[model samples]
Structure formats: C-alpha cells, structure tokens
Target: MNGAESLVETLVDNGVDICFANPGTSEMHFLAALENPRMRSVLCLFEGVATGAADGWYRMKDKPASTLLHLGPGLANGLANIHNAKRASSGMVNIIGEHSTSHLKYDPPLTSDIEGLARPLSHWVRRADSSDTIAWDTVQAVEQASQHPGKIATLILPGDTSWREVSAQVELPKRVAAQPKVPKAPDAARIAHIARVLQSGEPTLIILANKATRGLALERAGKIAAATGARLGSQFFTARIERGAGRVPIERIPYAVGQATEFLKGFKHIITVETREPVAFFSYPDKPSLLKAEGTLVHTLVEADEDSALAFEILLDELGAAHAKPVLQQRVEVVVPQGALNPLSIAHALSAAIPENCIVVDESLTTGRESMGHTMGAKPHDLINNLGGSIGYATPVATGAALACPDRRVFCMVGDGSAMYTIQSLWTQARENLNVTTIIFANNSYAILKAEYANMGAGVPGARALSMIDIDRPSIDWQAMAKSMGVPSVSVDTAEAFHKAMADSVRTPGPVLIQVRL
Candidate 1:
C-alpha cells in the first residue's frame, strides 16, 4: 500500500470517516487514495470552509473530523477558522500537504514553514518522515484530537511520503488499544470548600463553559443554584450550549464591557466550572478588562481538564442539595411582528419561528445581539457561538452540524459583512445537500465596527470613516449569489416575510438562504 492509502485506512479505523478537503498538486496521491469507499471526502472551495466545517462537525458529533489542505499557504488560509476551532475546543485532524524532501533543496515557490503556521492554532503538530511511519503518525494525530474538550492536530504530509510504496511485508504499527482519557475528578477538599461558600448565603454566580454548560453537568449546576441562592451564568460566547424551553436556564453574561460590569457588580462571589473568571473581550479606554466587581472572591470548582459533572455531584452531596429540583425555562408564546425589521422585531420573529431540536449557529454581530435572550423561551435547541470572536463562522459551522446530525436542521444567522468572508460555505452546503437554513441580515456594512468606534472613545465617524464601514456602494444581490451556488434563496424586507421565510425554509429540503433586507 502507498503512504496515502495507509493514512486513509488508519483514519477510518480510528473513527474519522469524514474529510473536508481543499487540495492542490501536492495532495494528488492522497486525493486518489480518497477513492476508498470507507472514507467520505468533501470538497471545500476554500481552506477556511474546510476547517470551519471540521469544527462544526466536532461540536455536534463529539468526535474529530479530518481536513485536507494543500500546503503552507493552504494551511494559512485555513488558520482563521482553526483559531476559532481551537478556542471552541473542537477536535480536528488537519492533513497538510507538503512538497517532497528533494524539492525543498531547490527552494520552490510554494514552499513555506508549515509548522510555523500551524503551531499557534494546533495542539499537536507532526510531519510524516516516511511511508512506514505515516500510519503511526495518523494514529497519534487522531488520539490528540479525540481528547476531552477536543484538540487540533495537524499532520504535515510531504509529496514523497504520500507517493512512496510500502512493502507488503512491512507491518503497520497497531494503536495501543485503550480507552479515551476521562477528565480528572475535582479534588474532594476543593468541592467541600465550594460547598461551604455556597452555603454561606453570600450572593454568588457559578459561571459555566465548555462541557459544563450542557447535559448532566448543567443540571447539577442548576441544583446547586436552587439549593443555594447563587445564580447560574455562562460567558458571553460559549462553544455549545443546550438551552431554551424545558432546559435549565443559565444567565448569559452581557458582551459589552459596561453592561457586563454592571450586571456583575451585584455578585459577592464568582464560582467557575470548567471556565475561568469573566473578562472583557477587548480593553477600552478608562475601562477594566476583568468584568468581576471589586472584592469579589473567585473560586475554581472545575479545571478545564477536570470532570465538571463529577465536581457538581460532589458539591451537591456536600450541600445536601442532591434532591433539589432545578428551575427550568417555560415556553413563551412570541407573536410574529408585522411591519418593520428592527432588532427587537427580528428577534421576536426568530423566537416565534425557530423549530424544536434544531441547531443555531450565530454570527449575527449586529442583529443577533439580542437573539439568545429572545429565544431563551423558544423551543429547546443547541446553540453555537463563535468563541474565537471570528466572523464568517456561522454558515460553515452550520454546514458541519447538519452533516453530523442529519436528522436535525441547522439555522445559520450571520450579518452581510460576516457572510461574505466565507460565502463559499453555501456552495459546499448545496453540494452536500445539507439541511441548513442560512439567514443573512443584509445591513450592507460592518455595523459592529461602527459600534466599536464609539465604544473605543472615538467621536462620531466622518464621511470618509463611515465609507470604510459601509458596503452599500453596490448592494449585493444575495438571492443571485445563492442561486449561482445551486442553493435556493429568498429575500424579505419585513418581519412577517422573514418569519414566513424561516418557517417555510425548515419544511423545504436541502440548503436554503434567506436575505433579510434592512
């Protein structure tokens, strides 16, 4: 078998069957090897889409997905989403193609430092030295990616390594059969201390993130809040959160520095679970970077690599709150708005139209600021936010989520500005026929930047400055764009029309786009 074939076989045996690929000449052998029916290869027009899709897949499947990139430049193109995936703690295995060892001596044009490009975003990085070692390297990459909370693993494959023949007599190294690593249980003394703090009757907030924000871990946190008077909260941006009606409600910390500071000022203590103390996304003039109030004691209940569910269980036992019933969010009946399509109306429309058990990938910087709050009492669903503060993550992530959970629909909400960054994602969605409904809030500008300008202590923007934030010079026809990519689409200028579009898109099969004109 060739090195590429061996690598593909290893990936499938390790439970990584899906590959999002954007290949070049260096990956020809690997591309040929992908003909193996056991491995499903998806073509992404851009490397960023591939990486972002892998992130989405990991979030939904709780497993690693592989990505195939051409070279250093290709890996560089995929880095932004890799940054997003890393911040989200999504597991991904990236196979980056490299020029042959012989070609490096000539200093080829495509040659660049692949390792240098991957290190900042990847948890593990390795290069296949020979055909015989490719299988071993592939196994290591998959293992790294499969860790709890997930990790990014980049495996660089040189051209010679991919094409070289391996003798039939050479036996590939077997993966040491073992169970995946479980998160360490929190220290008993630490849980006892936290239990005491919770019972002190002091106002406290338990901040949740990562695995702690969902499932039984969330339930345990809710019980703690019920037994004590402490509130349950989450960071402004989280990787994946299971929320809405019938689920235990957790307060979302405000995103703006002033608003967050105001919201947090009432707390006397902040207990963290699998996340750190709250902090502002960016520093502004005359503003504190840390969001917690002065003199507030911060305690860590669960470390990132520690088991949050176990810690909560221990805390529950210590507090005698094991039988406490957590409060759940009740369903709210939202009436669909009619005329204007402002933020409030838009939020109401979404709250009314969203289906149950769907996935919501949110990157609507301007319009979706209030979406989470409005949708809190809607149907139960999984919500994914961009933790890395990167734009253009929603559509691609939605694409991946749909692939991972074929039975569920995916709603992608993104602004027009952010949508343009990875608009190529729509084509992949269409090609895959993924069940994704992409909503574009077409304000035709980087509206968030305009808000940030004032937030940063800058005065009102002049005409020239406004020009940089506006994109209305020639308004983009989103319907035409979607149709060109083989995805059906519609345009709406009113809340009612947009709501109808959302409801209708869910019933329709395959990918669809809704352009909400502001």
Candidate 2:
C-alpha cells in the first residue's frame, strides 16, 4: 500500500471518520486514497470552512475530524478558523500536503514555510519525512487531538512521501500503547484548599468554563453554589456552554470592561474551574487588563488541561453537596414579539422560536448581546460562541454541527459583514440538504467595528472611517445571495416578520436563511 493509504487506514483505525477538505494538486495522492469507504471526505469551497467545520464536529462529537489542505497557502487560508478552533479547545487533525522533497530546492511557487504558518495555531506539529513513518505520525496526531480539552495537530506531508510505496505500516510502540486514556484527577490538596476558601463566610463566585460549564459537571457546580451561597458564572466567550431551560444556568460575565468590573464587584473570592482569571479581550488605554475587582482573590480548583467534570464531582462530595437540588431556569412564556426590529425585539422573537435540541452557532458579535440572555430559558440546546474572536465561523460551524447531529436542527447567527466571509457554507449546507437555519443580522455595516471604535478610545469615526464600516451604499440583498447558493431565504424588516420567518424555517427541512434587517 502507498503512504496515503496507510495514513488513511490509520486515521480510520483511530476513529476519525470525517475529512473536511480543500485539496489541490499536491494532495492528489491523499485525494485518490479518499476512495476508501472507511473515511467520508467533504469538499469545502474555502479552507476556512473546512477548518471551521472540523471545529464544529469536535464540539458535538468530542472527537477529532481531519482537515485536508493543499500547502502553505492553503494552510494560511484556513488559519483563521484554526485559530478559532484552538481557542475553543476543539480537537482537529489537519493534514497539510506539501510539494515533493526534491522540488523544495527549486523554490516552487507553492513552496513556503508551512510549519511557520501552522505553529501559531497548532498544539502539535509534525512532518512525515518518510512513507514508513506517515501512519505512525497520523496516529500520533489523532491521540494529541483526542486529549481532554482537545487540541490542534497538524501533520505536513510531502507529495513524494504520500505517493511512495510502503512495505508495511508503522505500529505504535509498547509504551505508547500503555498511555492512559483518562485524564488525571485534580490534586487533592488543591481541591481541599479551594473547598476551605468556599467555606469562609466571605462572598464568593464560581466561574465555569470548558467541560465545567455543561452536563453533570455544571449540575455539581450548581449544588456547590446552593450549599455555599456562592454565585455561579462563566466567561463571556466559552467554547460550548450547555444552557437553556432545565439546565442549571450560569450567568455569563458581561463583555464590557466597566460592566464586568461592576458585575464582579461584590465577589471577594473567585474560584475558577477549567478557566483562567477573567481578563479583557483587548487592552484598552487606562482600563485594567484583568476583569475582576482589584481586591478580589482569584483561585483555581481545576486547570484548563485537567478534567473539570471530575474535579467538580470531587468537590461536590467534599462539600457534602452531592444530593443538593440545583437551581434551574424555568421555561418562560414565548410571547411572539411585535413592532420594529431592534435588539430586544429580535431577542424576544428568537426566544419564542428556538426549538428544543437545537445547536446555535453564534458569531453575531455586537448584535447578539441582547439575544443571548433570552435564549437561556427557551429550550435545552447547545450554544457555541466564537472563543477566538474570529468572524465567519458561524455559518461553516452550523453546517458541521448539523452534519454531526442530523436529528437536531442547527441555527447560525452572524452579522452580515461576518457572514460574507464564509458565506459559501450555505451552498454546502444546501447541497448536503442539512437541517440548518442561518440568520443574518442585516445591519448593513460592520456593527462590531463601530462599537470597537468607541471602545478603542478613538475620538469618533469621520466620514472616511464611517465609509469603511458601512456597507449601506450598496446594501447586500441577503435573500438573493442565499438563493444564489441554493438556500431558500427571506428578508424581514420587522420583528413580527422575522418571528414568522424563524418559526417557519425550523419546521422546513434542509437549509434556509432569514435576513433580519436592522
């Protein structure tokens, strides 16, 4: 068998069944090997879409999905989304093909420092120098990606290495075979210390992230909160937060620095689970870098790489709160919103329409702030936010989420400006006939930038600056845009109309779009 075949087989053996690809000539051998039915290959129009889709797959499946890219330029094209995936702690295995080793001295047009391009975004990076080692390398990459909290692994394959014949595949060593699959439990001493702090009569807050924000882990955290009267909250941008009615609701810390500072004022001790001390996304002039109040003591019960769920379980037992009934959000009455389209009305409309078992991919930026709080009581659903602060992730991510959980509907929300970046996702969604309803907040401008301009302490945007932010001179017709991509769509100018469009799309099969003009 050829190296490409060996690599594919190894990936299959490791249980990575999907490959999101945007292959070029250098990757033909890998492409040819894709005919093996063990692995399903998906074609993405853009490399960013492939990487973003892989991110979404991992968030749903808790496993790595492989991405096939052409070369350095192809890797570069996908880096933005890879950055997003890395920040989100989503597992991914990227196979970035390179030119033949012999062709490197000639400085070919496609040749570049692929490692340099991948290092910034990848947790593990390796190159398959020979056909004999390619399969071993593939398995290593898969293992790295499957670790708790997940990771990004990039394996660079030269064309010659992929096409070369291999007598036999490389096997993992005995030591590698014995490596533990389970994450190590948190330190007993540390958990005890944090428990002591929680027992103090001072006001405290428990901040959750990663696995601690969802599932039984979150329930245990809620029990701890109930027992100690400690507040529970999460960072503004967690990867995947389990929210909605019936789930224990953890308040998301506000994004605005001043607002977050005020929100954190009452807390004396802040214990973080699977997250770092809260910090501002950007360093604004004169603003403190940390979000917690200056005197608040921040501590860690679980580090990011540790098993937060297990840690929380231990803590629950230690605090004698194991059987404590946790507080849950009550289902709110969904009153169909009426009147003009604004953030609150849009929020109310969505609170009324979002279905149970939905996967919501949010890249709505400034426009989504109002809607996020309302959705907590809508239904039991998964909410994915942009942890890397990257735009264009929602559409592509929604497409993959739908693919991962075919029985559940996927909802993608993005500002019109961000949607334009990976809009090709709609075409793939239509072609696959996936159940995804993409909502475009058609504000006709880069609304996030307008808010950032003020936050950055810029005096105010002049006509030229406003011109750069505005897309209104020739506003995009989203309905036409989506239809051109084979997605049925509607343009709504008011809350009532948007409510009907959202509700109707949920019942329809396959992909659809709703443009909510602001």
> What is the per-residue lDDT of model 2 for residues 1-518, given as tens digits with 9 covering 90 to 100?
78898888888878888999999999999999999998988889999999999999989888889999999999999999999999998999999999999999999988899999999899999999988888888878988998887899999999999999986544532223114457768998999998899889799989998888888788888888888889899999888888888989889899999999999989999999888889999899999889888789999899878887788788878888888888888898779889998888988998888899898888887788998998889988899998998888888888888889999988899999999999999888988899999999988999888888999999799999999999998999899999898999988988899999988988999999999888
TM for every model, in the order presented, reads 0.98, 0.97
What is the C-alpha lDDT profile of model 1 across 1-518, one tens digit per residue? Answer: 99999999889888899999999999999999999998989999999999999999999988899999999999999999999999998999999999999999999999999999999899999999999889989999998998887899999999999999977887775543124668887999998999889989999999999999889999988888888989999999999999999998989999999899999999999999888899999999999999999999999999888999999998999988899999999999999999999999999999999899989999997899988899999999999999998787888889889999988989999999999999999999999999999999999899999999999999899999999999999989999999999999999999999999999999998999999999
For candidate 1, report its TM-score. Answer: 0.98
Which candidate comes out best when scored by lDDT?
1
For candidate 2, what is the lDDT? 0.89
> Residue pairs in steric clash, candidate 2?
none
Candidate 2 has its poorest 10 consecutive residues by lDDT at 171-180
Residue 476 in candidate 2, Cα distance off native in Å = 1.3
